[model samples]
Target: MTGQLRAAIYARFSTDMQRDASIEDQIRSCREYAARQGLKVVETYSDRAVSGASLMRSGMQKLLRDGRSGLFDVVISEGLDRLSRNQADIAQIYQSLLFAEVMIETVSEGAISEMHIGLKGTMNALFLKDLAVKTHRGLKGRALAGKSAGGLTYGYSAVHQITPNGDPIRGDRTINNGEAAVVRRIFQDYAKGISPKKIAEALNVEGIPGPQGGEWGASTIHGNRERGTGIINNSAYIGRQIWNRLRYVKDPATGKRVSRLNPESDWVITEVPDLRIIDDALWEKVRTRQGALKSKETGVPVWDRRRPRTLFSGLMECGCCGAGFSKVQKDSFGCSAARNKGKAICTNMTTIKQKDLEARVLDALAHHLMDPEAVTAFCEAYTAERNRLASAATSTRTTLEKDLATTKRDHGKLVDAIIAGVPADQVKDKMIALDARRKELEGQLAQADSSAAPVRLHPKMSETYRERVAALIRGLADSEGMEEAREAIRGLIEKIVLTPRADGSGLTVDLHGALASLLLLATGAPVHRIARMAAGGQNDKSSAGAELQGVDMIDKSVLVAGAGFEPAAFRL
Candidate 1:
């Protein structure tokens, strides 16, 4: 009644658990606890029906932001499980609050960080790990059980079924009569030589709302032109569901990254009795044409980008939208979607020849970065450095884990004594002191694992011997392939900014950030300027420049020796 209190309460429930449990109940419990402690209650945060395991939780992000801003001195929750079901997520949030000097009070668990409290924290972390696994298992089971585990797909609906004994159940259904009619027309139209945009326009002209009740876009039209799902390419119009045309996998290890062509054993198929979107013959024609179209103009296949090709799509970044530019000619490239809709979003389209940019970039990387031998040496050095730190990290983690275990055992004894009617103030002081020590140990353990022992590598050129220096420089100059180039680029050069380096009219290379970071750092020398630098005493820029390295490292200005080289048309 006398003073104001500021508290933020957080609650979460994953997708599996019926519905998100009561935030009101959590808040009420928190409010009562705050009242008992004569503390004020200020703000509340809730993420209704969102997984705590997800990295992009907006509710948790907002809570951390407000907490760091000092809008709340304390955060109350039902338990650690409600706040997060992921250990890493919980740890990150815990660190945020600890750094911001906020107190975390759990109504049921009391305060944090006694040997017992810390043990409970570990248990809470374990609970989340187990919860994430359990939730995934349940979902996979539901999906395997021929249930609609997710939303109604673009062309299908949920149907009711009855067993032979007459009990009813919900089942995944066939294409909707209305949507199926639309699907057949789209495939037939495409095979008859209609473009995707034309198909989209025709659909819009007829006023068919797209899958989600929006005006049809090219992407929507393109995506729905699939086969076998009977949504797009139903081989079944001639009567058959090609049950397993394609499959995909979501790998959990790397955050559920999708992979194509999961094995046939993984598919589930139930044929519709009297439904078909497109006939087998038409499906075959569409598939053949689509394959041909793709082979003619290839994109980077969905594989690892560890070995980057000098593809125009990889090198050219749009100055306006920051999207990578796509190739227009074998010589030059422009934006893929710059003026997508009547020059609407972006009207500016810039093009640059491939050979001109590639040569200079390769040379610049060579001059700045180390080559293959140096990278191998560096990798060896880096591995040793990491192992040294890893050893120390392991040692420190082991000690804290032991301490945490001991503290938990002690906490159990304290709880038992309290429950048996121990005196309040006497037991309370001991619990608080134990909690504080546990928290301090935790801080030390976190700091050790985070910043850890330093990697020993002298940045000073003088400290490095002449052999090492030669190896380093030569590594950049003679890096045999793209991997060495990329390594040297990542290590020495900060960023490679591309612009019209020759008098702002022609393209050239500039390595700025890491060049400055690594002194003896290589900087760009546009041909006009380099010629002047080379002429020793002559003003080469006024008269333009002369060819030196030909098209290998210098621009056409240098290749032509004051006369621009004849532009050659390259067949892609």
Candidate 2:
């Protein structure tokens, strides 16, 4: 490396518990190293309070993007672990930088390489695992001693104290008198046959703050019975502390932690009489009521249900407060916030029959939307954009083709030299580098060709769309394949907003269809299957929306061109 080499500094610290100045310290050391080597620091990137276990951090991603764009010649970090603690992630970063012809230098490791990534990555991963095990052990001891093992439950406040050695005591809590009174009131209300939704509404009306000082919600009161969550299910109010009831594991694909329940035998139960908020009589009464309610709704748990029963179950929203519209009765839907959080949150008390709402929305989808003129205009616009993109891709493909030819020609020369009695070792590395470049260029050319492939729209796209929608609507009437048809139809809708009419007639409905999904449905494609494939086999509700925005194929104004209904006063 020469003194004129350009370098980018990258630094990161793991958690909020760590000092913010840790990033500054790491950057300072990297800068000092760069100065000592006479390397020009072109830029610096830092991720504060972000874990190195994942490469999803914004700063790290930006660094990799810049590296690939040839913004710098080298990356200077505090250590290899600062880049990533995950073995696979570290290896990926190394290969990416290698391909970009960028070097990685660290203060602790000097220069990173394949060997360093393997050994140091393993050590860092082990450190994380060991730390987790030790932390869990300490928390388990605290739970066994009847101290809080996790977050402070509602109706309690953290009790901070110092030990004899002047060390701060952790995991101690005391009952909050005001919150405890509220908890008792909730138990009394539930035992007296008041539903959780009604209790939540009354509490909100009284201006009582729910957990975390947020507005009260029915789900906050009536939590999962199996998970023993929610205010009512929390056994801490009954002088019992439960620990290790659930374990969380990080999803490899998403880098998000998902929780799994532990068996009852694995749960640790401890008694703490001093923290009790509800007496035995009130507790038993609440439990009995909950058991009776559970018996009444015994078929399938809501979480276990694969799909919603109704066509517009999760699609309706309240225009006034931007809250969801849910089933308020056996045959109608209304603003959930108004019904559960009271008029203070939302004044929209308007309700619409399920049959009527479905009929209106389906009619709009089949007839008003997807006009022939609009469809033809959209096809023309898509064709023009596709040609423009193809033209750009052709230029890129040409460059890649030239580069691939040059690489192959150079590789051939090295091979010829070796065959002409030249030492194989002298040209082995050069030939290998040229071969890698040739393959990379070929891959890029292949991708460009695929993207530039022409797409043709059906001539009678609007008619096809209407026919598909009609078929789906008719399928809703039949029992066979009804669920599949329902899911497909639902996938096309983004949301349906209902607002109260100014003249007090009734609620006005506004439907927003996902443009990409509508186009796919119009082309006789399975919208649900395409969306699921895009989301890696998961049913992502927003995948169609994402594709529409990312592809930029359709104009927004064309969405409801022929629909007679005026646009809603507000958009959600």
Candidate 3:
């Protein structure tokens, strides 16, 4: 029986700071142990730089799956804690393996039992808690002593030195003159009523690197106010170092860390006046502007708010500067960069009435788009792809049904064994595992069965598309289900480009409809291939708009409208 038994090696180390060779060493030791135990080492699994606190690790999950499938009769790890540190997780792992008739043996602990899991898991959990408390305490002391307690802030550089006792001095920082200038400029510009988006665009145009040394974006400058995260909210700019303002906890469902605000009483504030980058007056001005903006937003009704309320609010772009077009007045949209960052960044100041723009776009979509030839081409390609995917899904559903049937059979055998006088304790874990696997397989089969049916193209697809567009236009005038119709129509458009007419008369509109969305709207069937293409398409307006200037399709994937000076002709 030992000679026939198959063994699998498993190992894990918590962080990148640990040695990569640690995994190799653990696996080698496990192989040697398996050889001595007269078992064939058939597979190896390891998770590098992954914590034992969660079973979300890919390697661990694969090991469990293979065990349940009866690929391995025994699992070897360096220690019980290597599998899991949490008591509940370790117990669950044990039960899962036991139900699958797989034994776990650690090099250090030998064969694992319930007693080992309970004792070792509790010890490891306590160790993690103690480590966190001690680490926080040390950081708090460093903060109180006027030293950096976290990652180095953007405008500061680390000062490395050695203490007299031969220990390295950590957390000392000095102001970076170059970065300090940028920080001061940001504060000054925001104080003068420049929006964060405008500030970011202007800085990017001048080739200024952001906090992470990449292209700047509005969110980088206007981070969450309540969490005090953005550049403008950094208290360090005012000679204050605030520590413990937020606490992070791991989300059990997703195994990701999320931050929560800590009480002000728990905060540790230190004065590092030498590192000051912004003056009190400039800081106060930024705070006042932030407050005023917040108040203005709160006082407005939700429907009339400055946020994206119109159909094409976020999809409109300026042809001159490539910045987004936003509402500049009560009823008109203009280039945001030109109005906010001045003419230096963008020269286009053209504005168009919201009503006129919508009317023109809707008219183009209904009358000029949806050519018969293009619709036919899209239908053939879409039907072939949909049928291929449907076939693959059917094969997958068959496999799931087979696995589910096997799980149910195994569970019935365990029940019969219990009824025949086998101790329930001996096979209870296996029965539970089989039941869970059966349910999981059944769920997957149900999802596969519920997938959209194979698409059959309508003979008059283009006509249907035109009729749908007309209905959508009518829906805009009605109050009931207006939002739904607006979203449906908006989904068909990738973006709209607005440029100042050469004669300085008005804005020239260029509408680009997404090919995938158009095909879906026309056929009333899902087209997975074209949908992926549209989703993954580049958003660089300069290159895309130039390529689409007078063309119907760019690389046979997009539909362009307003190909020439006339703004009402949509082509595909």
**Strongest candidate by lDDT:** 2
Residue-level lDDT tens digits of model 2 in 1-572? 56499999999999867899999999999999999988999999999998887888999999999999999999999999899988888988998997677999999889876568879989989988988999899999999999999988999999999999998899999999999999999999989999888899999889999998988987788788789887888999999999999998888878778889999999999999999999999988988877666334555544233333588887788989999888878899999899888887899999999999988888888887777776776667667777787787778677778888889889999889988999999887677668777877888777666555554575488898999889888888789767767777776676788999999988888778666677777876764564353334223544443443323444232266363222321122
lDDT pick, better of 1 and 2: 2
Cα lDDT for residue 279, model 3?
90
Candidate 1: tens digits of C-alpha lDDT, residues 454-504: 334332332232233345445545546434433333333223334433355
Winner by TM-score: 2
Q: What's the TM-score of every candidate structure?
A: 0.55, 0.84, 0.64
The per-prediction tally of clashing pairs is: 14, 0, 1
lDDT of each: 0.53, 0.81, 0.77
TM-score of 3: 0.64
lDDT by residue for model 3 over 455-514, one digit each (tens)? 456647879888877887798888985766776677677778888888999988877776
Question: Whose TM-score is higher: candidate 1's or candidate 3's?
Answer: 3
Clashing residue pairs found in predicted model 3: 99-430
